[model samples]
Target: MTAPTLTETLPARETARSWWGDAWLVMTRELTPTLRDPFSVVFGLVQPLVFLGLFGPLLAGSVGATVPGGDVWAWFVPGILVMTTLFGTSTTGANLLFEMQTGAHERLLVTPLARSAQLVGRAGKEMAPVVAQSLLVVLVMLPFGFAPHPLGVLAGLVLLAVFGVGVGSLSYALAIAVRQQDWMFWAVQQTLLFPLLILSGMLLPLETGPRWMQVAADANPLRYVVDAERALFAGDLASATVAWGAVAAALTAALGLVVGVRTLSRSTR
Candidate 1:
């Protein structure tokens, strides 16, 4: 028995599905592998968990005073969630790269699905893993004396999903841009990822840093999101921090989606 081709799996033109329905189909196809191999999700989690275990304790001991409520878990855990979003969503393009190599991307391009749906569907899948990792991190920290407000944490997850969608879309755009030379994808990703992480203060507070560093952080959108996550996780939902974070997340999502869709459309043309 032979495997079904991309067109065989996609909805037929006679089906008359909306753009969202088409996107759903692409998302389900993209997610099928991750669903079948649960270990991949766990494996993807190792780095964030390790950072939580190792760097978290050191952060608490060293600069616990700088953290809100002087509770490091409250501050650190949300940052880890953002970190999970960053690392997890940023590398999603690698899978697209593999698809390109295998001619799977080309096959999908020739299908009747909307081009934007391909990018939207692919980026949408990023939310699930980040949600799982965020919940797991919260659960793991609870035993260690970490507690978050229920409603606030739920809101934080919504923000995280919005942010993840944007970052994931940008990553896919990068993948399409560098499809001709595979190594370039990794090169650009690594070069930009750490700077953004450090500037965003995911592992540590940046308040005591030099004025220049603080100014740089102020410009980084990720910083606002992290601040919002901290406030939300700490159950302070009605803060200026949360408002700024929501704005940043919304902007990033908008930009990432536009770039991703345009790139995919141009590449296929």
Candidate 2:
């Protein structure tokens, strides 16, 4: 005739144990608000599509000349796809800052959730919009003759998801570091993201950039990503391009997650 105490029924430290489960919990928490507002998701797609639509065709002829036998849409779609992930993941830190300021993060800290899982879950969930944008980009571009091979498209999505995790984690780390300073968060994100995009050879051919720019691009990890994406988009999978790109993306994700976890844990402490 014994009754279980509240503590026995609900162990605070045992609330979340599995890393993947904790991550999934965090992801769902982040996803609900965004899902409720469908417009926000759709709204984010407009600018990228606009670029794909207006920018793709307009620069196709000029950029196509750079490739040996360029199909205008072929040359441009991959870069646009990369840009979609970039734009989508660049704001990862902002919303976290909102949660921090609202003391939502403090509530999370009291839970048994792993600190890294917080970032992993949030960043991992961002794949939704990124993949959606990828699909939309392909669907929209398909009509205009952007004929990406099936496997290539699948590989490209993987590339984007990997890259998005990296970028999103970086944003979270930066955001946590600057949680009290909203202005600095925005400034740093905008400052770093656009420059990285430009240097990645997304909008133009890397070979054609100025000497210094080409040198800079050579060192940029994103260059590998774009190159891989471009090759995949063109259905050329039998090359080192995808391998190199995967390595770069994996490196970026690893570094970002490590940094993000450490930063968030320290901030909580």
User: After superposition, which runs of candidate 2 have C-alpha atoms over 4 Å from their true positions?
Assistant: 4-16
Clashing pairs in 2: none
Screening candidate 1 with a backbone cut-off below 3 angstroms (N, C-alpha, C), the clashing residue pairs are: none
lDDT of 1: 0.90
lDDT of each residue in 201-243, candidate 1, tens digit only = 8887788789999999999999999999999988899999999
Candidate 2 lDDT over 28-115, as tens digits, reads 9888988898777778878887887677767765666775346767767888888878877878788888878888888998888888
lDDT of 1 at 22: 84
Error of 2 at 137 (Å): 0.9
- lDDT, each prediction: 0.90, 0.84
